[model samples]
Target: MVSVPTHLVSADTEWSPLRSVIVGHAADSCFPTAPPHMIKATMPEEHFASFRPKNRFPASLLDRADAEVRQFVQILRDHGVLVYRPKAIDWFAEGGYTAAMPRDGLITVGNTVIEACFAWECRHREIELGFSEILADLEKDPVVRVVRAPKVERPDALYEGIRGFGQKDAVNGEVNGTHTVHSHEWAINNARPAFDAADFLRFGKTIVGQLSNVTNQKGVDYLRSAVPEGYSVELLDVTDEHAMHIDATILPLRQRLLIYNPERVSKRALQKLDLFKDWELHAYPYQPAPRENPPRYMTSGWLLMNVFSLDEKKVVVEAGDVEFAEYIRKLGMEPIPCPFQHVNSIGGSFHCTTVDLVRQGT
Candidate 1:
């Protein structure tokens, strides 16, 4: 079972478990397929090198995203929440853009964080503590069931078939002129060798429609072992042949209320999410935009929308993402904005930064 912390505990206070998410940026070393050589070869070295590793915000930074990430996270923590952050080279590499300081970890619940699955998940990258310790008392409360993922082998096949194009070698940087593809480290690749192909048979049979593109065989494997028995995870085959990121499509915002960009997510995943009638779904009408290759929409994954502070009728989003202010207004949520904008290029928005630990009780 998970743990919950509350310094000023109240009997009536209930917990939704999936609370607010902190907004911050970290290097995704193995996952995003960022090998310096491969990245440089594919795009203009100048464009890729524009942002050096630093903790500064917008004007000083290449994209003015770091400030957006850090401040947003800090605000969430201030609101009594738990935040989980990645600590490592990839999360802060040249391509990465997180404030090296420790205060920028994450906000999971209101203020309490369960540190049980910390280091193993590489969330802190081994780096610990960054936010104001003055809030430690409130931050220590934990009310969550931590589900740790078990290790698996042959996780590569997922990225292999999902990420790279036809006939491209994933193990090494293979190229055709300017385009290059890199292998992923997150994929599970272990098996009896002989039964390796058969290992996925059970999951294969469950495939009712298109499978999610961002989800690899490894992600599915995670559900097989860790997901709670009553709560199951179904990989929706939601892929918009035109979009780049998948997680952005089937977003899990605040548990019940979610904004799904069906265009970006596969139709199957959309159906799966719809199956849960208990929750209300807000479908986004995102008309396909011309593919902007040069600056790929600054990788707005989820961090931008992670931590949403609700003040009765309004919800606050990280100011770094300009849309935060506007988006809240659209949701009938008063947009409480901030001034952070130092970490957008890393491929995350306000929502992408932190993994939600807990929410207010439903």
Candidate 2:
């Protein structure tokens, strides 16, 4: 009964000629009362007060982000790309939901589409918003693999300290032998099978990912095994102290070019990674420092690195981030500027809000 596409359903790399994509909806996207570990990880210390359960995202900000996302969709449609939007849901009334940031929940590998296991209870239902759209894609592309992420273990409190260092974490119940705990407490713990779609970046034959508060070692392992034969997954040594998604920290412009935020890449890992030495690693230009009390959003300013690619030579950037665009030009790519500050205030930009569903060729 499902309609399936005869050819592959997805593009292989970030800069490939994009043909189809899923654009997230800002409308009805609800902010979570109980944020996941990764959400807490990336937040600035001062903004902690805003994430409290009772807080609601300013309606004005949501409207701006929604307008910006619509503009982005128009730009893609103008370029002849097939764009799909997620069905809207009442995230606030139906419990915690994140309407935007689709890149955090869904991803496509080759022709296969995978619905990732979100790391927090707050976002567990996010995939529901896009279920109809993904099902349609599956009907059209039967060969595409659809892997549902494994169920995760949710504890009352995820402890982050050594077993003996602090009184056994009474919150999560059982005290496991680990150095960290993943929770609202922001502690480190044994890596488990918890991952967010944003933690991955795809290349033709390989994928590069990072372990952060949102993604655990086991989750990375699961991903490594899920891909089709001939494809590989590599874990990057990026600092995950306030671990979250990697799109803002490292971006591959093309096979040979990479853009990174120096603050996020670990100094130790930077020295040991020989692959980086061979590629043209352009340290992204400076961004204005965060205000003394930056408006506490769910994410950090590194969202500036969240750029989207039309192809190896064309990419979408924020209209206000002139420095990022200039750097894109320096890399020999054309930067298409769009207004995204409002949507960004909600947590992500073009790359975060959009997921590529099809690229032109292998």
Candidate 3:
């Protein structure tokens, strides 16, 4: 029997039976504007020009994206899962990105929900403008806790000393009085804690994450401090040079079974973690074909791995990805196909659009 959750926020693993979640809206979602260096580092080269200030995604795309999201919410409701929607905001007016991908801004660990300290200036106010009301409502639960990101006083300091395009070079730096130097030169410096919540994934008491263009060492340190007691965060060594979010790198279908992108992460690297010592890890055998008509502006075709799990037995997948759907079916999962290509074009897929608020067990 599934136990009822007393708090409004509680989730530790990605494959648990989801009871409540937040589904984002894609209306008025503008392309996120950032420094040329940062944009070039993380975004796809073909879509570089779209990262201009106040540039809205094509109206046709946003309309279809919003439709897909609404349909997705209805599907969740039909399954008896509670769904929360963010307050719609004009991204063009605010000079910010879309509220469509809330997974990048907030993560739920145990009974607490923690916000991300975004590296991009345009995303600093993302959660504030879109999801504050929901956060306030969650706070009403006496057993729930919300940890908001500390306000950044000097955002430009993050890019002060960085130079050149994507390359690997060492640079000495100081973050919070500790001297540090990374082997690879990222777009942003470790001036402050900067990370998108999507960089980390939960697995029972052990939460695995990665250091990417958007997430820095200081950011990981901050996350370690914010998580509830008895929970820990570990970093995975990923090979993708243009790494941003780890959601596509690793997908945990359930407690003991996981599928990973071999092009980005290795089976050996996953074995290094004590958490996966007794788990079954499989490399995704098929290569996803790129989509051109709608155009994947932000990510690669591997976004197919960015699926949302409804529970241990049922998972949400893109309607077009029949290959992946069939593969997971062989692994004992029921893939519910939904038309989300429009949403994929905007930024992310189902996993990137929803934040699970409550699961059967923490």
> Lowest summed-lDDT stretch of 10 residues in model 2?
169-178
Residue-by-residue lDDT tens digits, candidate 3, 1-362: 23345678888999888889999999999999776767767778788777778988999999999999998988898888888999989989998999999999999998899999999899999999999999999999988899999999998888777764333322212121211224487777899999999999999899899998899999999999999999999999998878899999999999899999999999999999999999999999999987797999898899999999999999999999999999999999999999999999988999999999998877
Estimate every model's Cα lDDT from 0 to 1: 0.36, 0.70, 0.89
lDDT by residue for model 1 (99-187), tens: 33222232222222322112112222322333223234333445333332223243333223322323334333353112233333222
Compare the candidates by lDDT and give the number of the best one.
3
Candidates sorted on TM-score, descending: 3, 2, 1
Clashes of each: 82, 16, 0
When 2 and 3 are scored with lDDT, the better candidate is 3
For model 2, how does the per-residue alpha-carbon lDDT over 1-362 read when each residue is reduced to its tens digit? 22222454766788887787888878765556433233334565455445544356777777877888899998888777777788877666666655678888877888777776666667777776556566565646567777776655663233344243343323232223223433333333454566788999886877778877767676777777777788777888765567678898888887778888887785356446555566777676687446322253666667777889888888889887787788779778899999888787667889988888787764
TM-scores for all candidates: the values are 0.53, 0.85, 0.94
Q: Model 3 segments beyond 4 Å from truth?
A: 1-5, 165-183
Off by over 4 Å in 2: 1-8, 35-40, 153-188, 266-277, 289-296
Q: What alpha-carbon RMSD in Å does predicted model 3 have with respect to the real structure?
A: 5.0
